[model samples]
Target chain A: MELTRHYLIRRFREYYHKAKIYEPIEFRMREWAFVPLKNFPDFVMVRHVSFSEMEELREFLISNVPAHVYFSSAYYLKPSAEMDEKGWTGADLIFDIDYDHLPTKSLESAKREVFKLLRILEKDFGIDEKEIEVCFSGNRGYHVHVYDERFRELGNMERREIVDYLTLRGFKLKGTQFDRVCKIIHRYVRDGKVNVDEKTGEILRSSLNEIRKGRLDLIPPEVREELIERCLKKLVVHVDPPVTADVKRLIRLPNSLHGKTGFRVVLIDLNDLESFNPYVDAVAFGDESVKVRLLKKVRVNFGGERYILERGRHSLPEYLAVFLMCRGVALYGH
Target chain B: MRRPFLPILPYLERYPFLKIGSKLFKFSKDEVLSNVEKARDFVEKVLEDKVEFDFKPIDFLCSNCGIREECEGYEGCSYNISSAEYHLKLSRAKKAVLNWLRCKVVVSNLDEFLRRRFAVKLARLYRDLILKECDDFILFMADDFGLNHEGFSIHVADYLKYAVRMKSDDWKLVNRFLSKGYVDLSRNEFVRLMEKVIKEILMEKVQINLNVRLKVDFKRKELERLPLKVECFPECMKSILSDLNEGKNVPHTGRFAIASFLINIGYDVENVVDVFRNAPDFDEDKTRYQVEHIAGLRGKGERYVAPSCETMKSWGLCVWSCEVDHPIKFYRRCLSGGDKGKRSSKRKGDSQDYA
Candidate 1:
C-alpha cells in the first residue's frame, strides 16, 4: 500500500481549515508561494503571487489546501509581478541551519547550533535576541531570522562576509578572536593537555603574548588545518550561507504544515527552546484511529509513544498514520 | 583666459596626491598649463630620479607639539592640528615632488631593470611609515580618509567595502578586528590599513592629463579568440544557461556570476549579452550595462572573477557535487581529463534544475 494523493490532500485541507497561519510582519509586501497537490512527493512551486490581507491568505490556504506554503524573506513593491519588475526593498537576514549541514546530523545538533549562532551574533555582531525570530523548519532544521532594520539593507557581499565570520572561513592568528584561540591553546599546553614538538612546544609554553606572534605555522599543514577544523567544530556554525545571502528567497511560512512530515513549522521563543520536542510538540495530528499499511519496517518514538511498525497493514493513531504517510513510509490501507 | 592666483597652488605644489576640499578658487587646466615653465619644472624632478622617501613623511612630530609615545593613542589625537598643518605642508611638498614624479621613461635590458630597481626604496619607505606612523601625522591621514573617529572604530559595512583592496590577509574581518557590529582597530593598525587604502586610491586616481605614447608590449587580440572546447564547459554554467535558454527569471546574483565568469573566460560583451537574451526579464539596455560593467569596460574598471565554489554554493547555484572547489577548475578538470564531461552530460534533468 502507498500513500494516496487524495487522502494526503484531504488531510492537508483539514489541517489548513483550522491551522492559524503566522503571517509575516509586512504581509502585503511579501510574495507568497505554494506547492499545490499537483504531483505527490515532488513539489513544483507556483510562485509570484501576493496577498493584500491575512484573511485572504487564510481563505486561499483553507480552500486550495497547498502541500507547502512559503513567503518571501524580502519585501518587494510589485511582489506579484515578474522578477525584474518586482522592486526589491529589503530582506530579513535569515540563517537557515539545516541538519544536513551541521557537525552532526540531528535536530538537537541543529538547535545547539542555533544557540551558538545567537551567542556569536550577540557577542560579536551586537544583535539582541529579541529582534530575531527562531522557528522549527518542521522537517530537519531551524530558521533563525534577524529582522533588525539595519540588517535589512545589507547587500550580498556584506552578508557573505558575515557568513565567513560565522563559519570562521578566513580566520588566521592575528586578531582579537585569534588571541582568544591562542590563549586557549596556551592554557591547554601549560595544563599538559596537548603535546607538541620542542620548537612549537617552547612557543606555546613561553607566553600567551609570544604565541600571538607565535609559530603556529611551525606546525605542519595537516596539523594546522586539523586545528582550524577543530576550532570550526567548536565555534563555527554551519548555516546554509545561500539562504542567508539570497535576499528574495522564499522561506517556509510559520504555522504552516510541512509536506514531508505533516508537522507544524512552529515558532519557538529564543529563551524557551530547550524543552521543545519536535516529534511531540510539532505534531499536528492526534490519536484518532486511521488505517495505514507500512511499506517498510519503521521504528519511531513519535508523540511520546513508541511504535515499532513492520511491513504490513495496521490500524494506527491518526498522528502516527499521518506522520508515516507524509514520510512516504506508509499508505492509505484497504 | 586670465590666470588666477590659486590659494591652493602652494598646497598642490607640495602634495600632488592630497585632496583639498574647496572649489573656492576655480582654475582651468589650460590656464595652469599656460605657464609651461612651471609644468616642465614640476615634471623634471621625476625625470632626474631625485624623489626619495625619507624623514619627510615623519618630521611632523613637532619641535614641542607634546606628542609622546603614550600620547599616540586616541588621547594624543587632539595634539594641535594647526601646528601639524604647517608641518604637513612640508611633507606635502615632499609628497607632491614624489607623487608628481610621474613620467620618467626607462627602457632597459632585464639585467638593467633588475639592477636599477629605483622604486624599491620608495616602496619600503612607504611600508615602514605605514607600520610606524603612530603619532599625530598618521591621524591626519585618517582624517583625510574621512573615517568616523568617534570612539576609535568604523562600522563593519563601512570598512568591509574598502577591505577588498587591502594587501595583507590580516585585514580580513574573520581574522580579527570585528566586534559589536563595528571593526575595532588599534591606532597603528588603523593607520596601516588607511595607508594601504591610500596607495590603491592614488594608483586609481593619479592618471596624468597628458597622453604621450610609449612603446609597451601588447597581447594580440586574435590569440584570445580561440574557442574553448565546448564540451569542457562546467555543468553549473550549462544549468544556468539552460535555464536562461528557456527564458527563466534568474536571480541577480546568478546573473552576475554567469556574466563575470563568461567575461573572465574571454567571452566578448556582445556574445555574453546575447546569452542573456533568453532571460525572461531581459532588457537589452539593462543587459548591456550589466554585461559591460562586469567585463570591466565601464564603471570603476574593476573586473570580477566568477565567485568561488563556496560562494556559488552559497548562492544556491551549484548544480553539481563537483570534485573541484572552483567552477573554473571544474572546466579545467574536464579539459584535462575529458571523462567527466560525458558522464555529467548524461545527468538526470531533475538535478540540473537548480532554479
Candidate 2:
C-alpha cells in the first residue's frame, strides 16, 4: 500500500520516541562513501515487499534501522561503519532504477506525476533529491531512502513530509494502494491548479500501457515539458513555506534538542514564508505559504539565535540544532 | 880527446849534411851551412814534408827525394812515400797501389756496364734492402724528406742508378764487396733482384733463357720462350679433369658443366651419357659421366624425359628459353620408348600442362 503521511509520521514517532527514551541514538559524524551492491542477493532481498500493509513496515524498517539500506540496482551502498573502518570517504552513488516495475513505471509515466511528487518534497516540503536518494528496486518496486543528516533528529511531522512527497510522486503499494496513490496525486495536482491538456489526459489514460510496454518516451516532449514546468512551478511556490515551517515546528519537540546548550529556542519567522516561496509562477503558492508560515513559527519558537536558515529540507533542522547548540543550548538534555 | 868542443862535435855531426852542402858551395862553412840548410829545409818542408803520415795510401808519394819536381801533379797521390807505411809499409804501399789500380779499372766502367746489364736488378735489391733493414731509414726519409711511395721509389731508383754507375765486369767479385759493405742486401732481396732482372730480360727483344738458381732452394722449370699463354679454366672443372686423368674423384663443376652443355646441344637429358662421350674432351665413361654431370644433363635412363618448358619456368627459368616446343614434347618424344604407364596418367594429359 502507498504509505500515508499519517503512517510515515507514526513510524517516525516510534523511532523518535524510542531514541529519546530507550537508546541514545549514537551520533557518528561521517563523510560519504558508496560501494555498489549490484548483483548481490542481499541488496535484492532487502527491497522485496509482498503485501500492501508491508509499506508501513518497510517505512518503519528504513527510518528506524541504523543499518545501511540500499536499493537493489544502486551503484553504491557503503555504510557509515564501512567509511569509519576504512577512514576514507567522498564517493558518488549512481542508482539504476528498474522502470519495468509497476510503481517505478507509474512514476515514469506522465513526467508530471514524478515531477509533481519531487516538486512537493523539494519545493513545497523543502526536500532535496540529494538528501533523499531514490532508485527503482530491481524487481517490481521503487526504493526511496532518506539519508539526509536531518533524519537523525527527524520527528513525526518531518518524516510525514517525506512519505507524503513519495506518495504524491507515484509510489504505491499492491493493488488498491496504487489507485489510492494515483487518486491522491491527482487530487493534489487538481487542488494546486496543475493544468492537464487533452493530449496529456489521453496520455495519462494510456500511461500504464505505455509504462508496461516500456515506452515511456511515447509522451511527447511538449507535453512532458508542460507537465514538468507546471508541476515544478506548483511545487516551487507551494512546498517551501510548509517544509520550512514544518522543520521549525519539528525542532520544538522534546527530542529535537541542541547538543551544546540546554535551551530550546526558535529563531525563524513565519512572516518570511513568502520569501521562502520566491517562485512567482508556482501554481501551489498557497500551499508553499502555509508550509513556510508553519516552519517560520517553529523556527521562532525552537530555533535559537545561532540558527541560520539553510536551503534544503535535511539541512534546515541540523543547521538549526547546531545553531542552537552554538548558542549554548544542550540538545541531549532539553 | 879533450872534453873541449864535445857539445860542438855533436852539433857538427848533427849538421854534417848542411856542412857538406855549404862547404861544397864555398864560403864560411858554419855560416854557409846554416844559410843553405835554412833554405833547403824551408824548401823541403814547404814542398811535401807537411803531408800527414795518416794520409790515405792513394795519396802516397816519395816526398824527400828529388822527385818533388815530378810530383807536381802527384800531390795527395797514393804513391807518395809520406803517405805510405814502412817495410811492412812498403808491402802496404804496393797493396794500396794495386787496390787503387783495381778500383780505378774495376769501378771505372763498372757502374755503367752493371747499370746497363743489371740496373733494374740492383734497383730492386736496393729497394728490398731499403724496405727490410732500412725500414726505419725509409720511414725517416719519407717523413724528413717528404717522400711518398712514388717519391721513395724514385729516390731508390736514383740510388740504384748511382750504385750501378760503377764499372764492374765481374758481378761475383763486385757482389763480394757489395756483400761485405755496399748493398747490405739480404738473400730475399737478392732473389727479388734476380726476379727483376729476369723480368727485365724477358721484356727485352733479345732471346734469353731464365734458368737462374732460386734462393728458395726449389727446382724451377726453365722458361725457354716468351709470350706463354696459360690456360685458366674454372678451378672446379680443371680439378675434375685433373682427377679424371689421375684416376681421382671428379669434381661437380665438370659434371654440371658437361650436363648443361649436353642439354644446350638439344640432346635429351636421357642421352646425357652419349652426348657427354661425344664432347670434345671426353675420353672414358668416367670422363663422360663427369662431363654430363657438369653439363647438368644426367638422366635416370635412356628413355627418361627432359624437363618441360613449363617445368623449366617453374624452376625459375623462362619457358621460351627451353628448346622444347611444348612441355609434353619432353615426355612424348624423349620417353616414348620407356614403360608407357610409368609416368603418371595426369602428366600424360593437359591437366599436367595446366598444373
DockQ of 1: 0.30
Model 1, position A182: C-alpha lDDT score: 60
Q: Candidate 2's error at B267, in angstroms? A: 99
The reply for model 2, stretches above 4 Å from the true place, is A1-107, A110-113, A128-148, A155-158, A165-334, B1-355
For each candidate in the order shown, give its overall lDDT on alpha carbons.
0.68, 0.30
DockQ of all models, two decimals each = 0.30, 0.00
Stretches > 4 Å off in candidate 1? A1-6, A196-229, A301-306, B1-150, B164-168, B186-259, B269-304, B308-355
In Å, residue B135's CA in model 1 sits off its true spot by 9.9
Model 1: lDDT equals 0.68
Interface RMSD of each: 2.6, 63.4
B1-355 per-residue lDDT for model 2 (tens digits): 1121111122122122212222222333233223232332222222222312222122112323344453433222223333223234434333333332222222223223232333343333334433342233233323322222231232222223222322232211112211111233344433343334332332233122222221223222221111111121122223343455565543343444434433433444356565344344566667555444444344211222233343234333322222343334322333433433223223222454445
Question: What TM-score does the first chain of candidate 1 have?
Answer: 0.89
Q: DockQ (C-alpha) of model 2?
A: 0.00
Residue lDDT tens for model 1, B69-180: 5344332244444545545554545444443434221111112222123233233345565565445545555565665443457666556655654535677778866677
- What is candidate 2's fraction of native contacts? 0.00
Instruction: Indicate the TM-score of model 1.
Output: 0.62
